[model samples]
Target: MYRLMLHGGVHVLEGTFVNGAFHKPLFFFCQTTMSTETDETRQSLLLEQESRHTANQHTHTEGAKMPNRKGPSGASRLKKCIGLFFEILYWLLTLILVQFWKACTAVALSLMLTYWLWGGWATFCLMIAALIGIFYNLQDSVLYFPNEPESSRLYVPPATALGIPFEYVTITTPDKVHLSAVLFKQRAELAPGVPTIVFLHGNAGNIGHRYMNLHELYAMCGCNILAVDYRGYGKSEGVPSEEGLYVDAEAAVNYLHSRSDIDQSAIILFGRSLGGAVAVHIAAHRHNRDKLAGLILENTFTSIPDMGSVLFNLDFVRWMPLCLIKNKYFSIRKVSRIQVPTLFLSGSSDELVPPKMMQALFRICGAPSKQMARFEEGTHNETWRCRGYFSVIRQFTATVCRPGSNVMEPSPSPTPGPSLADYLGRVNMQHQDV
Candidate 1:
């Protein structure tokens, strides 16, 4: 029997060799034929592989020579266009609603003011005020622009964005609304008399909106910060009302006061814009006036009516009866009663709240020793960027609030104080069965 084996396309025929002589010449011929066939097959395979490799290279080169388009794909562009259209439509609808709301509010206010101008009695004014207060119950929805994250919206936590050590505080207001706040602790051991600033932010946005302010306070002002979001803002619960916000501010003050690490007497209430009004309201309250060390108001307006007047450039808005307004942050009336050492800071070129209004507020401020810092050519948001912003605060704070100093009493005034009776009457009227 003869055996044939194939290895790497090499053919081998094995047989007993008769003294180095071929047993069958045919066998040798067959083996040589097989070997030749195997060599030819191997060559064909190599040629085939080479041809395939060349074809692949040619195809790749052709693909590479094609035009390079850098923008989005046609499908992606269509999608983006659709999304933009929807966004525009949504804003358009929102604007229409806002315009309608404004029209209604303006007409109502115009009539009330017109009547008051035509010798409307206090009783008639009170009736008009009640109706206006009910109308503005949804005012928060219009005023507050919360930075709530959804879709492409951006929101960064205070600790991460501000680059400061902070704690998320959940405060429950007396009305049982859960409010979100950020408390930035001092890095070093706080000096005995050094204070913490309870930062009350403006009408719109959350506590995180004040990250720059908090960062500056932490780095330059040498004061720890505790900033709270009002109801319906950020993570806070409930709708915002004038009284509800006051309760929120009280809750913040109380939270800091409860902490053993904090100096209750050294706590300073710092407010900017609408927050300035909140701080003034809190400092003016009978209970909180003696508790807080000082008040720092920056670029704040007098009241809502005054704000509407300035914002709209309407002379009639200024003449509107303030008692009829709900959500009245009447800082002008309240500022005159806040006896704590106060600092009134404003930008000379503030567009939102006129510098003159801040000056008027400073003039009427009942604080025993108050200082005014004006940044010429500074706009509303740019007040802190003004020169000597932090220095002025530090200097003013040092004199007014030493750790061991006694709480100052409210200075006696020759003129009668602003009455909250009309304001409270309006609020109570809203709750009455009508």
Candidate 2:
């Protein structure tokens, strides 16, 4: 019998059981013609597949080898360079315009001086007009002294340098200005009821300059201190203005209210010099006036107009209209609106703000309770360094803010002192004797 089998796509014929008996060895014959045809077809198919694969690989390799022309081109680079050049040109033109304006101002002033010296009435009138205009435009710069000390603008030391535990905070005003502040907490664990002081510094320097004073206040009063740099001072953003400072103070107070660690009810506003005016503004207008524990004003002027009269001593300047005074911190007018307990820290020898100003404020204050402390040898800036300075503050805070109470206790009325009229009379007599 003969049988056919297929192997590897080729046909083979096999013979067995020859002559009615199975043969021990089987005989096989391959179909050579069919096998040859299948091998040729397979070889052709393999060659075609290899060619397709090689072609795809070559195409991919060529694509990868090609440079990416979609990247930044020469024209884009040139455009960027041109944009940079124009920006530099714009700044240069701006600087030149500023310098030219200054030069023109100088020449105009010189001509006005010459005409005035020669008794030219018409030119004198013109000079006065020019001066008024200049003053109106530059009043903000004149009133704010954030960079008076050169180092104030260049450097602000961290609160940690004084070995006090502090957190650097940024507060945002409603007007979108960012204020830099340092919150100094006690080294030991602080009670939730501990009073927090919002320290508003004077006009001249950043909060860093007040760190030593803050350290002393923190230790003596045993209160958390929040020292803030007003707008345009230190790392704060924006130019300083009278309204801006008021909003900044409000924002700080709101920030204290937001914190869980702070006692919002026992918050105190401490202001020195220009800061006193700010403190008065906030205390007068605070929506949560009942929550405020106290207000502390040190060596603070009564008003900008009063300061003008004292500082210039010129009849025209002294009588200048309030409308013409652009930056008017009229604290005297606002103090009567404050409902919180108040402390007036005065320096008798203060060369800047007269101690009489503090006295006048104390007399006018509408707080439930008020007290005045005078340091005889203290000057405007050194009052805090005087003995019993912190003691007075400690006593005042203790009286007003009771521990573990969210609502401040009503402080007892302060002991009566000399009347404002009597104080002024004594001051006048002293001056006359001098």
Candidate 3:
């Protein structure tokens, strides 16, 4: 009948008085032995845990001291080397293409002119021949300015960035050249038989440069627009030439004809500057003439030879034979054959192309319906920024391209503005004063 009890953290053994002192002595011995075993087991566990912690610390310290022995793979090194080689090659080619040829031509022309000044009549004749050859070869460089402003060829900002939904398209010319283009459709559901404009830009810059104009046209006119970059411009392939540009325009129109979203019968061709020449060609040609609903020409020239006479003030350059000119746009000759509704947007203060040329084109245009909008303070490049530029275009398209619309009445004559000669005279006077 011995009983064990805990008192103040000590184990006490108690027995009834009947068992006497013998039970107490045996229970006490048993309690002491059990406490000793428990203490030993606790100490052993603490020692084992401490030893494990120390081993783990040592392992981590050793790992920290080790270094990574592996280097970049052979494939990585090869790729870097190839990239460097191509970069060097690209710069070298650029220098040769842009600077070397130009430098050589300049030196050659200087030497030839020096000889012509001091030598006999035979030398003069040879110099003339050389000049003709040089002009012929370099005409493309002077006419096509896709690289002007430097940034034009480098990057073209996307239409989507301006919140205008557009489709980036590639048009293949009949000659197998690829051209870059953008198709912008109105966000709202268009009514049946809505018109589409084939936007042809000037010689310099790509389709992206015309984003602001395109945006305004799309929003204000409420029409579908397909803006295309001609050959050798933007992302389009092949060199730019007068014939090549005409081909590019034809290809763009043909592309529209193939599309289901576009209304082929309501297609309009809108061109500015050199593009105006291209548009006139398309509108006059037998193939595309009947398919077009309207024509829009802005700040465009008459012909390459006419522009040369205006741009080059020297008597010798102005008097040069027109046959020497290689890229003759000859828009004046072509405008007489256009048989569709036409709109002429003229900048009175235009310094590049004479306003008279635009007026002449409008007068002679064979289109049954036509209108001329004159912006008095507008310049060659800034005419599109004029206050009533887009409104005039919107009005023309609305009146001309609407279904069953037969309005062929000509617009009233626009008031004449300052001529290019007057503008240039003022410029010269200002420069002389300065």
**Over the stretch 165-227, how does candidate 2's per-residue lDDT look in tens digits?**
788999999989999999987544453667889999999889988877776676666778899
Models, CA RMSD each? 18.4, 17.8, 18.9
Model 2 TM-score relative to the real fold? 0.66
- Write down the lDDT that model 2 would get: 0.77
TM-score to native of every candidate shown: 0.61, 0.66, 0.66
Q: For model 2, where is the 10-residue window of minimal lDDT? A: 425-434
User: Which parts of model 2 are misplaced by more than 4 Å?
Assistant: 1-130, 286-288, 402-434
In the range 1-434, model 3's lDDT, one tens digit per residue, is 33454433455454333324332222322333335557675577447555655665576579788977889889989999999999999999987767544523444455476775787777667667666666677877878999776877767778775566678999999999999999987544452246789999998999888887677666656677899999989888888999999999989988988887656778889999999999999999877776888999999988887787788765465456777778889888888888888888898999889999988888778887778878887798888766667667766777777574322222121223322222221110000000
The lDDT of each candidate is 0.70, 0.77, 0.75
Give the poorly placed runs of model 3, Cα more than 4 Å off. Answer: 1-128, 315-319, 402-434
lDDT (tens digit, per residue) of candidate 1 on 1-434: 24454544454454434446544322212234443566676577457555655665576579789987787799989999999999999999999767655535434545566666775676466657556654565555555565443410135354666555678889987778998888887544553335778998777767766676567656655666888888877777886777888889989999888887767778899989888888889998888877888889989988887887767678797676655466678788888787788888788888778888888888888887777777775688777766666667766667767657332221122234322221121110000111
Q: How close is candidate 3 to the true structure, as a TM-score?
A: 0.66
Which pairs of residues have clashing backbones in candidate 3? none
Cα shift from native, residue 111, model 3 (Å): 11
Q: How accurate is candidate 1 locally (lDDT)?
A: 0.70
Per-residue error for 432 in candidate 2, Å, reads 29
